[model samples]
Target: MSIQYVGLKEIKGSLIILEGVTDVAFEEIVEITLEHGEKRVGRVIQITGDVAIVQIFEGTVGLSGSNTKTLFTGHPLEMPLSKEVLGRTFDGKGRPIDGLGEILAEKKIDINGSPLNPVTRKYPRNFIQTGISAIDGLTTLIRGQKLPVFSGNGLPHDQLAVQIVQQAKIAEGKGIENFAVVFAAMGVKNDVADYFRRSFEESGVIQKVAMFLNLANDPVAERIVTPRCALTTAEYLAFEHNMHVLVILTDMTSYCEALREISSSKGEIPSRKGFPGYTYSDLASLYERAGMLKDREGSITQIPILTMPNDDITHPIPDLTGYITEGQVVLSRELHQKGVYPPIIVLPSLSRLMKDGIGKGYTREDHPSVANQLFAAYAHVQEVKALASVIGEDELSDIDKKYMTFGHAFEKEFVSQGRNENRDIDGTLDLGWSLLGILPREELDRIAPELLDEYYKPYKKKGSDA
Candidate 1:
């Protein structure tokens, strides 16, 4: 017993107000039929007394208050799910755009997702190696963790992301299974969108990727739905099919801007930087969905990439994101200008969960110590460079000159790699040890004496022999 109401009380931007509506709920879907029988979709966003305010997904360019008919569908937005969703592309609204036709849905799931209880959450461990030395050897991305890449406008974050997709894999002997990637891009230009598709296809990882793209010209409402739809698909694959899923959400800054626009249209009170006060909770609703369930064999890892406005990390988007996610991979303009491919400033970038995930049985016995030494050595590099700027390099001590040499070689050999180069964890660790060989053994205070005797001494001996 559904009811259709002809005519409306008011039309405001993308919203239409209905008077005397009963039994309607918030977030419920609504159908808008125009005078000539053209149809549009909307959802109930706000309710007051017996009146409902609906925001149309498609804009209300041709609608009038009296000529349109509104009907409540009594259900929230949902996505059609099947394992076939992989290797396919869909619009932000969960409609297929790959010309592959609609999915034969095993089930239609609410895009809002099922609520996960905190008690059922399994602690994240075991790293997912991105194969980029800056990430793998330093800011390790742990499975079931939500780590973000904080980039800026002109950086090569897109290239870095594609490289990660092409090379990311679990450590050897962890499991025979390979994980699938769900890539969602919000408010990206058509050219950028095409690049993502073409890169994935050319790299041969497209078969395992599910892309949800909301182009720059698409409706703003779709930007809001894009990531939600992608996460829902990942949730189904991970929890039901028992597959490890890694979800990459790019340009979340656009999504937050879309939220701000919608909030302005609704006349809501604006909070910091014109963003709604509920931004934190709203983000939590999405980020908190990532993790492994205690009873499930699979996991969901999230790498949410957002560009800070004007490279300002304090902007509301990245600021709030830093508060929510585990840790951030901060891209460096300095390094990018210096010809570093990944451009990740390892000092500022870290994975808080790396301690539990790497070392011993997970990656390698020397991983933790090597990573710590890299950080310490890099930090000293910056200091020595600053000192050399004031007093000439000739005036610096021998140890300081050694640090400068180590720093240059570290960036050129370790951080910079070919785009297609895929290094295993062992290769990454060996390269790290080789770089440590440039510094004297006494400076490697982070490593145990035994580990230095094992990994560092061999590298120092090889350097001496050469």
Candidate 2:
């Protein structure tokens, strides 16, 4: 039999203090009944001796200290799992919101997730093609890797995320039967949520996506649970059903802000920028959940997108994220001003796991050489532009002038693409070769002699006054 207690200890922000509670486990879900028997849900966030503090998921409103009845469920929050989760939409707490009714659960798993042993982990290999030249050719996203997109306010990160969802696939013409996506949006506006849903449905990719949405006006407590619920679903699909799952988490900064708010309400001592000191571990708990098990056939790849606070990458949230994830795709405000859609700052963005994923049997033999050469040529383009600003473009040497033309075409034709345009790997690679043709043959130093002979077709430099 369960014990019921009349709550009257205190009412704080999103938390309600319950006195004389026994045998209550931490993180256990609670059932709160008002005097008139309106049901509300909560979770045990803190336990000090016999006093327990519960965070209400539906916000703490309309409850009196004298008339409230609380019951501890003695179990942590669990998400119902099945193959039916795909194409479904759920609230932050894993409750169905799409009017599809409840999931006939095959089994229920804890949202906190089962701890994965580091020794049993498998090294990531191969790449997930996003069909965008900038991502596929440069910062390649390997299967089972955790790569983040570092964006800022008012950038086009949302559009980029949508594009990836629509176009991402396992390499080498692998069918969609084995791939799926899980998207979580925390603290987004209702219109933005509607846009995400509409865009996916219109693109016909919604059937493979499961979305967890926590709106901006929702309780802050729900924001904290959003990503965990999304990952829990991904794990179920990947490990149980042997599906390669790609999980996209957007606006993680909002989740951290919710943590800070909860910490402030708990009266805990503040750390950097008034956030809890455990911020790093908290983020790691989410990111580390992605990977392939040594013996498992499936994998989970994560692309967590967070907007930098005040466009400052040095802020504590991004600074700590840099330490946890493999590498980042940093967006450029300068490129945005120049009418670039994705606005990816190529020089600063990279995937640490990319080298192992591309080349030979994976993407192409020339992928590594082409990417390295592009990085070198773009770096030189910056130098020539700086010199041009100082001494004007007309005074530059012939080779510098060639670089000027290459840079212009590179950004216009390569970095920028239509919102709906999707290119295959061969199309992207062939485009890279064509762009390299703008430079002289001697300038292509990164490729092997045989590859240069086979792929390089140098464009003749234009004569002065011609």
lDDT of 1 by residue, 1-466 (tens): 7999999998887788899999998889999999988999988989999999998889888997788999999999999999999999999988999998999999999998989889999999988988888888898899999999999999998888889888888775534355789999999999999999999999899989999999999888778888999999999999998888999999899999999988898899999999999999988888888999999988899999999999998999999999999999999899899988888888889899999899999899999999999999999999999999999999999999989988998888888888889888889999999989888899999999999888884234333655
List residue ranges in candidate 2 displaced over 4 A: 173-175, 459-466
Estimate candidate 1's RMSD in Å: 1.7
Alpha carbon RMSD to native, model 2 = 2.3
Clashing pairs in 1: none
Q: List the residue pairs that clash in candidate 2.
A: none
Residue 320 alpha-carbon offset, candidate 1, angstroms: 0.4
Candidate 2, backbone clash total: 0
Error of 1 at 175 (Å): 4.0
Across residues 305-407, which tens digit of lDDT does each residue of candidate 2 receive?
9999888989998899999999899999999999987798899888999999999998899999999999899999999999999999999999999999999
